[model samples]
Structure formats: structure tokens, C-alpha cells
Target: MMLYYIYDGTFEGLLTAIYDAYYERENPELIVAMDNFTDNFLIQRRYIDTDEKKATKVHNGIINKISEDALTNIMYAYLSEHENAGKYILEYLRFGFKVGRLVDSYLSDDRVHNIHKLARKVSRERHLLLGIIRFRLLSNNIYYAPIDTQYNTACLLGDHFAARMADQIFVIHDVKRNYGVFYDKSKWFISDIDTKGNLDLHEKELFYQELWKKYFESTTIKDRLNPKLQSHFMPKRYWKYLVEMK
Candidate 1:
């Protein structure tokens, strides 16, 4: 029977699971999220509860022993929210602890390569979202933008927007995840947001939306229209939030 470790799907929980994997010597075939676990007669499942101390110890060790960039890559991979992200992080750490900072140089190794691939995917989405995200003026005077992303990237955008729009109050909501990063002009943090009907747009925002749609139509060259190439660059998935795409 193959052993599998399961956790609550948080980054800290994943680190705690790794701590157990190392200290208990439970050589599991996979590290999986509790919600994603599949019951199988041939697999032995071990549940790992999130412990801050143990998680912190492992987090510190990764930074102290391995490179800080390794931790950043691991965090990016974790934010990917991919099914295999936890497993890849475990394998990456196992190899990293042995080779120290030089572990990143082993791109030929599948363990190292898997993490880099996930991180790159997440980084790409973050960069793209920064350009494509559109904010609307809220009735409460806050700026709000809703996004549905492949990876967990709403929180990743907090720093960039906060720096650029320092004097503005805004919220970047991740529709799929049901959470947001809110900025109050001075500080920002990730927290649960009310997604109900209360988020009414400011009166002028509706006019602005209409104006943007008109601008899009007016600027288009009908004779040279190429949706295939447009979709390739803009991606169809992001159109849901685009006011002009409506």
C-alpha cells in the first residue's frame, strides 16, 4: 500500500505536513489536500493538522538553509493551487535541503523543474492581470475589480496596485476564491469580502463603463478584425470582467 499525506490546503498546513514527513520518516508517495483526497483501499492516508510552530520551523529552515528565492518559488507554486503543487513542493524541499542553494541549478532534475514550471505559470498570470484588471468606482467610493483566475493571484497583485494607487482605496476580488485584497490608502491585507448585492457601482461609473465600450467600438478597425489573434493575446477567459466585452 502506498502512503499519502493530506492537509487542510493552506501553505502553513503544507509545511507542517512536510515537517511530519521528515521527522516521522513517513515516506509518502503523495502530499495531497484534504478536500482533493481520494479514498483508495491500496493507499494509507495520514492526516496532518496545521501547526504554526512546526510550520515556522520548516519555513525558517528553508530560508536559512536553502536560498530565499527557493522559498519564493515554493510560495508561487503553492499559490498555483494546482492538484500536484503540494507534492511538487515536498519533493523540491527534500532535494533543496540536501543541495542547499545550489538546488535551483538542477533544472535537469524533474523535482526542481516541476516547481519552476508552476511558479512561472503563476508569475505570468500575475503580470498579465496587472495590465488587464479594470477597476470601477463603487457607491461607497472604493475601487473594485472582480477577477476569475486560473491560479490564486488576487493577493499577488496587492503590492503592485498598492504602490501605484497609494492614495486610493480599492479592493481586488477573486471571484472564484471568494476573497479579496483590500487597500485603505495606507495599508493593505487579504480578507473576506462581502460579494452580495451591496457592491453597487457609483453613479458615474455606469456612464464611464458605457463610455469605455463606445471608445472600444469607435477605435476598432472593422476591415482588419482578427479575433483569433486577439484571443490569443487577450485570452477569452478574462473577458468576463472586461466592461467593453459585455
Candidate 2:
């Protein structure tokens, strides 16, 4: 029987699923997000909601079994939402279980190398967004930034902003994911904000957005314009949240 483990699309959820599968002694043919489910009678699948306590235990176990860097790499790969991420994670976990502390050397193996490569790509994008994401100050003294990312990375991007913008109140919305991070000087929290509803923007914010749009247009050289090249650099999907693109 081909068992399928379906989970909520969160790092903790994935880890919980991994723990459950291992404890159950079942090798899942596939592990997929709940949202991606397509009912098929031939498959024996089970959906699991994330259990924080179990996830924490599993996370601690992995850290104890492998180096902290290995744990980071696995989490990064999980956040990427890339195809084959589940399979790669399973492979990595298997290697870690076998070698206990020497799993890092498995980086020399082709299977582990591919997983690390994908994890690095996702990590780089999350890091870049930390510096590149622009925020507009509203009249209420709250800063707002809307972002559309290829990877489900709003949570990943929040840590950097929370640390850097410690003195100000700000929110960074991942329009693609319909979730955002809101941070005040004292505390930071993550929540789902509806993007379809009225977006609160002040006149000053609108002016800044207009100026950014104008600047983007002005900087572009029509003579050298290559839509394909531009798309390659900044994917069109991200244009929706970009102030300059608007």
C-alpha cells in the first residue's frame, strides 16, 4: 500500500508529519500539502494537522542527531515549497539517522547535494527580500509593505525586519499568501490579513508610491528594453506588490 502523508504547509507541520511517519513505521510514497490534494481512490492517504509539542520534540531530536547547520538546511528546504522537498527531507533524515552525527559529510553525496542546492536558492531569495523590500510610511505612523514572493517566505522575511525596524511599527504583507507580519517597537506577531479588502493607505503613502512608479519608468531605457530579460530578473508574479511596478 502506498501511504500518503498530507500536512498543512508549515515547517512545523512538515516536521510533525515526518515524526508521525517515522513512529508509524510507514514509508510514505508521497508527502504533500493539504491544499494540493486531489482525491484518488487508489491511494491510501492521511492528513495530519501540526502538533507544536510533537514538532518541537522532533526538531530537538534532529538538532541532537545532526549539527545545527543540518537542521537549518532542512528547514530552509522545507520553506522553499519546491517540488521534491518532502522526498529530499526524507532522504536527509534517513542519512542523519544512520550516521547520527556525521550526516554533514553526506553533502558530498549527490542526493544530499541536490537538496542543499535547492535550500540555498530559497534561503538567498528570503535574504534578498529582507534588504530589497521597501516600506511606505502611512499617516497613522504605521509602515506598510506589500510583497509577492515566489516562495512562501513572509515568515522568513519577518525576522530581519523585526530586528532592524525595532523602533517603528510596520507590517509586511505577502499578498500571494494572504499573510503578513505586524511589528511594534515592543513585540512582533504574524497574522493573516485579507488583501482583497480595503488597503489602508494615506495620501503621503500614495504620493510616495506614485514617485516610485515614476522613478521605475524613468530609469528604464526603452531602447534596451527586453521584457523577457526583465521578467527573468524580477518575475512578473512579484510585480503586483511592487510599489514601482504599480
- In terms of lDDT, the best-performing candidate is 1
Off by over 4 Å in 2: 108-110, 210-232
lDDT of each: 0.92, 0.80
lDDT of 1 by residue, 93-161 (tens): 999999999999999899999999999999999999999999999999999999999999888999999
Tell me each candidate's TM-score: 0.94, 0.84
Whole-model lDDT for model 2 versus the true structure? 0.80
Any runs in candidate 1 off by more than 4 Å, and if so which?
A: none
- Tell me the deviation in Å of residue 180 in model 2: 0.9
Model 1 residue 237 lDDT score: 96
Q: What is the lDDT of residue 224 in candidate 1?
A: 100
User: Which candidate's TM-score is highest?
Assistant: 1
What local lDDT does model 1 show for residue 196? 74
